[model samples]
Target chain A: MSTKTTRTQDILDRTPSSIALYRLLVPFVIVGLWELLSRWIGPRVLPGPVHTFSALYEGIQSGWVIPNTNVTMQAVVISFLIATVIGGVTGLILGFNKPAYDIVEPFFLSFYSVPKITMYPIFLFIFGVGLNTKVGFATFSSFFPMLIITMGAVRSIDDVYINVGKSLQVSRYQMFRHIVLPYILVQLVVALRLTFNSAFLAVILVELFAARSGLGLVLQHAMGTFNSEEILIVVTVLAVIAFVINIIFYGAQQLLEERWNMTSDEQMGI
Target chain B: MSLTGLSSLPYSKQIRLGRATLLVAILATLELVGRAEWFDQLTYVPLSTMVETAYGLLVSGELTDDIITTIGLVFVSFVSATLVALVIGWFLWRHDKVKQVLDPYLIVLYAMPIFVFYPMFIIVFGLNVFPIVLIAFAMSVTIIIISTANGLAKVPDVLIDVGRSMGLSRREQFRHVIFPAAVPYIFTGLKLGFVYAFIGVIASEFILSNSGLGYQISWYYQQFQTADMYAVLLIVITLAVVVNLGLIRIEDRLHRRT
Candidate 1:
């Protein structure tokens, strides 16, 4: 019975059309409810979706929104890149060397455990309130998860793999490139997703806290001026952008994991 | 040093000892640099002064109140996030097609910087605990959903079959089999959710509010009262560490019970 069902539904199982439809319907239902509620509550307290969408459109067209978004994206992208390179290198070094891990692991743990925003003011004073300062803060906040996850991934490699490489007379460089590098790549993908998320949060925090131009700055201005329409538009755009990025990265992670698992299975003759 | 002598110490203990020594050495170096005027140009108070100020802040009622508010907000948000995640997660679990449809949406929602939504929250909820709590909830809810879904998905099929064989209702099977199996995953999600919620509350307060530890830190920093700023920062860090450790302990205990 199970085999027959599996065979019969193989094609249907592969297609997620129903799921996609449900997803679309759910959001519409939610938005419809929100629109109804907001209309009932009135514009001053809760603006309807139509008003919010129009406000967002107008705000963007007026050039009030784009500069801020560009500035914020610039900071986020730069910091994210810096964090990835620095964290990847540091993680590789620590993961490969047991003594170094013992020496530096504690500091990383302590710092990671601390609420990073608490140190923002100090960063502000040092770096000043500009693009560099926001980027610096974002980088610092994002580096930890990448470093830790990468280190853990590297450390978890089987001793048997190392022994096998040794038996094969693999050169140090070859061992690193073939065995260590590929092993860490899977973990790195996961780390990248997390790091990107952290970087976004960090950049947003810095921009909101003190920025002359950025999406955060615009949101702050809207809040201060009590411009609910503008605020709604900016936030909705940011949320939509963030959501899209997350979905892309999640798909990448899934693909990487599948590929990695397949490669491992083939290598093990499983 | 003889390899034999080193081998006498357990590997875990050796690692712990080495880590502690490294931390102490780093702290000592910081103290020395702080004591010497070598980096006087650096905008930082000496370690001793910061510690002293931190102690003072700990004794103050204002700082205490701020800490309490932050913690209260985290707890409220975390509970709501957990409940929401559980409901959504269960729905997804019971219906695979729904899970597939919503997976993309959830991932996107998870990735988005929730801080961006603060303005909307402020407009809707006002510049009070509600906005802060909402921020925390928003930050945490995604984690709960992801973790809960993962947990439920990982439940062994055999267990579900056994529950069914015992004449358990769908709800009973969920409560008796699915929930217990999913608890660890849920707790893992809770741990991450709690951390994000804590940070979210503080961050919201920092950006918009006039009260809370984050606000106090910002206020002190703006006033150029470095000591007071450091003091508040220390209290905030201590609270975060304590809360994280407490959560970890709870997770461990739950894991053991399961």
Candidate 2:
């Protein structure tokens, strides 16, 4: 059995580079196919890879990447911060008090599915066509997921932790700080990751609907002029930003998990 | 101790009372604020006015037409996306090599705001319902694929072994054990798919379409018809609430079976 396992391990070690190559092969094949299709259908219908890259390169050189990206990120960061503080506090209150949760949970759940963009007009009407409406909408869109997750995280804490705190005669603040906060910290980070994604999406959405600046507005303009390659560039830039956010949050989540000595899934009771 | 003792009271009745009270309080506060003109006239609309406007629109069958269009887009896109996602998810699950190679891209796609592809979609499908439906499909299909494939991956080898040891054939093992295990995850995917599909459709309407609830809201806002905008929003909120509640019910039933 030991010899058999060693043989398999040796084979696995030998194949790591091959696996990496195989991974690259998939994207290579996909791009090749896309390029072929674009050629066949004509660039008017679907721009080839070369055209997409050129547009993306031009977008960067012309400073299109910097300003629009900054606008979207500003909205995301501002809204994320506001939503986190508000949603976190609200969640803590509701989670700590079952009566409050019971009173409010139905409303939260019901409105959870309400697409935030549907309320953009009301926001636009009130705040006008600029950053305030965009940020407000972004905050509103991202708020509920964080609220729900934080509440769930708090509620899912094993009751034994609270009982231990009570038996040790810790003050309520001390109990919450040492026990409850530590327990829910990982989930809170996870919630921030989710909120970040939603916030950016919301920001882009508002920009698409009624913004003078941002990537979404650029995409809208591109669409208006039938600039498919430029549109693709904008989409690619947004995807890269999202990927960076994911990496940053994931790293933070890992750090928090290590410090807190708990995984989010375990805290979630999954 | 007192709190624990109070918990023994009829839980359902207590919960219902709490919800009702909270709803009433919220509505009353909004009405009061609107009546007192707390905010500027341009900023706030009372719930009564919103309802009245909604009723007017309903009687005229305008909002209903938009609702029907939105629902049709959602329904078609959702069904088609689910089918495609299931096939792709199954294929990915079957091919471990492809799964490993593609997982990171899928994760990026999941986080990426695929709605930004509207321009590209419009380029491809033109100015019609197809772009809206495709946007929704693009948003949802990735989620379905991930959930379904992840579910398949998570089926315990021990359970599979049990099936095999019971003299079950490969196909039978998959049918009885693996498929049942994955059903819950598939439902989760479906629920998320519905949400993204709903958002995508509404958002597309706002950006591109001339009809649908989203367009009505935009149109009314453009016209400076605040009451009409709020009325359309009320209908949207109602639809959201009903769909959410319905999904929850279906989820609960599925979870019970598992």
Model 1 agreement with the true structure over B178-253: per-residue lDDT tens digits: 8998888788788878888888888888777878888888888778898788778877887787777677678778
lDDT of 2 by residue, B112-201 (tens): 778887888888878999889989999888888887787787777888899989999978988999988888778878887888899889
Q: State the DockQ of every prediction.
A: 0.48, 0.52
Model 1 residue B21 CA deviation (Å) reads 1.4
For residues A1-270, write the lDDT of model 2, one tens digit per residue: 112232233234543565567756866787799799889878877888888888788888999888888988998999999999999999998898877786687688668778878787767766788888888989998999789888878888889989999999999889989999899887888788878888988998888777999988988888889988878788878877887788677656656655444667421111
lDDT of 1 at B183: 87
Model 1 DockQ, alpha carbons vs. true complex: 0.48
lDDT of each: 0.76, 0.80
TM-score of each: 0.88, 0.88
lDDT by residue for model 1 (A111-201), tens: 6657687798888877788888898999999999889877777777888998899999999999999988787675677678778888988
Candidate 2 regions exceeding 4 Å error are A1-34, A170-178, A251-262, A265-270, B1-8, B39-43, B156-162
Worst 10 residues of 1 chain B by lDDT: B37-46
Candidate No. with top lDDT: 2
Give, for candidate 2 chain B, the lowest lDDT window spanning 10 residues: B1-10
